[model samples]
Target: PSDFSGFTVDGFKDEFEKLVETDSKSIVLDLSKTEFIDSSGIGAIVFLYKRIEKKNHKLMLLNVTGQPYKLMTLLRVDKTIPFVDSI
Candidate 1:
């Protein structure tokens, strides 16, 4: 997923919800190409995280960087969610 801003959050949310309906054991959001993220994007991610947790599935974020990384860190989303620089 790249550029997780307001414009992209809704699409991401819809796709994520559909994925969550499957039997996948885990979900790893690949943010390697993402350069920015806004409050709406953060909200969407949080919503997915909660839904995943309710389904007893694991959720992780990979390759976070730039403004997105800083904002996530500052908001303590990194602390609450699993995050890694790479796989």
Candidate 2:
């Protein structure tokens, strides 16, 4: 969604959960369109990461830029979760 803030995090969480059922070895969350993200959004990403990790699946953040990128970098989350510029 456009706004990956607290308002959209619940939906993101629900949708992300469904992705776990897919057979794909890697799950990528494209943040190119996300203009805004709050703590709730970050929490959702962390939660998703843990879920994917437990399943031995990989989670990648794609096109993360602007404030979201800065925040994740600042928190050192980017160190744990891989960020990809392309597929």
Candidate 3:
């Protein structure tokens, strides 16, 4: 997903909710190609992370770099959700 901002967060939330409802054990968000992320996007991801945890599931961010990485670090999201360079 690219430009993970307010305009795109709702759709992402809905789709992610579906996956959670279907008992997804883990979710890997691939941010390699994502160029940007706003506060709304961060909130959405955090919300999803909490939801997954409620079901004993995990959420991982993959290939985060540039703006997204910096934002995540600034927000201390990396402290909560684990991230990796690849799947």
Candidate 4:
């Protein structure tokens, strides 16, 4: 849940799936240290969002910036999730 420096689609997909099962109503993914993202990463993020919403929970993102941020913006994910700058 840190840098995701060597992120793979399967790894993120599995981890995010587990996160949505938590009792907490919200989850935050810290992406401040992440510098880039691929299509697989984007899909994993969207999967997290939908999973949390389906369970009436919130999926939050913090400290997400740089190229990853730009890609999210382009994909309109920023509009769907609340993100803070380096929180």
Tell me the spans in candidate 1 whose CA falls farther than 4 Å from its real position.
Answer: none
RMSD of 4: 2.5
Using lDDT, give the best candidate's number. Answer: 3
User: For model 1, how does the per-residue alpha-carbon lDDT over 1-87 read when each residue is reduced to its tens digit?
Assistant: 567888878776668878679788888889889988999988988888899899999889998889998999999999888897766
Local distance difference test, per candidate?
0.86, 0.87, 0.89, 0.78
TM per candidate: 0.91, 0.93, 0.92, 0.84
Query: On a 0 to 100 scale, what is the lDDT of residue 81 in model 4?
Result: 92
Pairs of colliding residues, candidate 4 = none
Model 1 RMSD to the real structure? 1.2
Off by over 4 Å in 2: none
- Any residue pairs clashing in model 1, and if so which? none
Order the candidates by lDDT, highest first. 3, 2, 1, 4
Error of 1 at 54 (Å): 0.3
In the predicted model 3, the residue pairs found to clash are none
- Which run of 10 residues does model 3 get worst, by summed lDDT? 17-26
Kindly list the per-residue Cα lDDT of model 4 for residues 43-70, writing each as its tens digit: 7788788988999999888877888888
How do the residues 15-82 of candidate 3 rate in per-residue lDDT, one tens digit apiece?
A: 87786786668789888899999999999989988988999989999999999999999999999999
Sorting all predicted structures by TM-score, with the top scorer first, yields: 2, 3, 1, 4
